[model samples]
Target: MERLQKVIAKAGIASRRKAEELILQGKVKVNGKVCTTLGTQVSSKDIISVDDKIIEKEELVYYLLNKPRKYVCTVKDEHKRNKVVDLIECKERIFPVGRLDYDSTGMLILTNDGDFAQMLSHPKFQIPKSYRVTVKGILDKNDLIKLQNGLVLDDGYKTMPAKVSMTSYDNTSNRCVLEMTINEGRNRQVRRMIEAVGKIVSKLHRMQYGCVKDDNLAIGSYRRLRPHEIKTLKKMANEGISE
Candidate 1:
């Protein structure tokens, strides 16, 4: 037996937090009766429904997608714009682990396992993500050092220390490419960090997430997670930064 919200989340109906909201709204029913209590438990034999529609657990599926720029990382877009899930031809309903800005692109993980998604998305997990960023102005060693030491964003939130290295620079264009590795997932963080340092971002691409990398996967393409990859992710999620 498990909490109703947990079961609903595991079935991919919604995240655990969203499932709780559904229960609070009197939309979830267990064994044909409305269940609004937070800690209600249910077993496999119990029937679950939301708004009179029955839901069942889906077989878990994991996918690694090389997201292309201009694609939104969401299950549904109000503007009817193309979403990352639409790019994949999978039968199971899988949502992105977190988010990548519509203008930025690269490695993204999609999965039906809500628990796994929660683990990866949670800040406490401190999952490392790396990005290759191009900016309009050249960044010097001091700038890189400042980034490594952390900075205060325009929003006044102090960014955690990040690993920044100069990849290359073009004198003719007055542009530079740098790589950054950070464990915190902030909104437009890399761009904001560069902006805080008096540079403007021109292009951004995520290159890695936790132990996963682009691995030569073509942009706009996706592949199944290998058994070993899934194992490693589970271990990382469980052990966190200690691993």
Candidate 2:
């Protein structure tokens, strides 16, 4: 037996939290009876429905997508913009684990496992994400030190210390390339950090997420994650939960 929300989430209907909301709103039914309680439990034999439509648990699927710019990382966009899910042709309903900014290109994971998504997205995990950035101005040694030390953002929250390294600089273009690894997943964080140091970000690309890397995956393309990779991620997620 499992909690109603957990069952709904495992069925690829919604995240656990969203599942609870659906229950609260009296949208969920168990064995033909509406269930609004948060702790309602049911076994596999029990009938489950949301909005009167019966739902069945789906086999979980995972994919690594090298997201391209101009694609939103969401299941649906209010503006009718193309979403990352739309890019992948899959029969099972899957969603991006987390978001990459609309304009930033990089590696993204899409999955139907809500528990896996929750484990990775939680800030407590401190999963490291690496990015390569191009900025309009060259950064000196002192500037690099400041970035490594951390900075106070416009929102008054001080960023966590990040690993920043200079990759290259063009004297003629006054542009600099930097690689940064950060554990925090703040919105526009890398760009904000560069802007705080008086530099304008021209381009940004994610190189890696936790143990997953862009590798040879082409932009706007995707592939299934190998067994070993999935095993490693599940291990990481379990370890994070235990801690």
Candidate 3:
């Protein structure tokens, strides 16, 4: 006994969100009766139709992308901006696991597997992300120590201690590249961490996310996750998914 929207999505009529819209508009019918409720449940044996058209189930797909800057992580943007799914263009209805801000670029995982997505995105599963960031000013020894030792933010929340190290620096540009690893994914956490030390982020890129890599995957390009990769992600999800 699941919501009708889930059945419509599994039957390939569109995404669950789209299915809900159809139901609200009185376009969905179950056994020749119009159904408009959001929580209407239908079993496998029930006859469901969308605008009098029959639907068939679609196979789930999982994919990963080396997302570039200026792209939203949603399925479709309300403002008609570019999205991650437009690059992959799969038939299955897939969505991003978490989110990367408009200026942030990194490895993003997309899938139609609801259970796996829910588990991985849940706060209980501490997923580590390694970011390669280029900042406007050079970081001194004290700055590094402060970052490692942890500092209080202006918003009155003390961030957890993080692993921060210098990768390289260009004296000409006066820009320094640093690698910061964190387990929790908070809103604009990396940029905020850099700002805490009076440094400005010039460029931000995620080098690695959990087990996913940006190796050989160019900006804005995506590829289907290999079988083993999917299996490993599932195992990680299972570790945190509550019964």
Candidate 4:
């Protein structure tokens, strides 16, 4: 037997955490009975339903997408905007592993493997994510050092120390382009980090996640992750990685 939420997540219905929320909302049922309990367990012989639809485990799939700007990273958008998942034509119930701001673009992972999603997304794993960021103003050595050493955001949350290096500075435009790698997954963290440093992020693009890179994927296009890419990521998740 396994926890109901785990089963639901493994079935590609939702993430384990979201599955728990569905359970508490009475949206999940087992053997025709509504179950709001968090740890309720079930076996293969039992019937499982989420929102009245029966669920069975799905063949896990993983995709690496070069997301385009203006696409939200969600399964459903009430505003009817373009969703990242809509960019892929897979039959599995795949969802974005983590998120990027609607206006931010680049390396995004979509997968139906719930445990793999949890492994990379969970804060404890500290999987390094690399981003190419362009800010509105030139960042001095002090600014770069502050970011490298970590700074407190407006919300009083201090970010973990990051690996920050300036790639270019345009004197004419007063814009600075830099590469930053951080392992923590705070909400809008890169943008917020720039805000904390008294700069505005004009453009933000994730370049890599763990061992996976955007490579030659065209904007809004996706492809299956290579076997070694997935293996290296899982190893990084289990053993951690350096910046």
TM-score of each: 0.95, 0.93, 0.76, 0.96
Worst 10 residues of 4 by lDDT: 234-243
Judge candidate 3 against the unseen true structure and give its global Cα lDDT, from 0 to 1.
0.80
Off by over 4 Å in 2: 241-243
Per-residue C-alpha lDDT of model 4 across residues 185-220, encoded as one tens digit per residue: 899999999998799999999999998996788999
For every candidate in turn, the CA RMSD to the true structure comes to: 1.4, 2.1, 4.6, 1.3
lDDT of 2 at 69: 95
State the lDDT of candidate 2 residue by residue for 119-219, as single tens digits: 78877777778999999999999889989999988888798888999999999999999999987888889999998999999999999888888579999
The lDDT for every candidate, in the order shown, is 0.89, 0.88, 0.80, 0.92
lDDT of 2 at 3: 95
Question: Considering only N, C-alpha and C atoms within 3 Å, which residue pairs clash in candidate 4?
Answer: none
- Model 2 TM-score is 0.93
lDDT of 4 at 145: 92
Which has the higher TM-score value, candidate number 1 or candidate number 3? 1
- In candidate 1, which residue ranges exceed 4 Å CA deviation? none
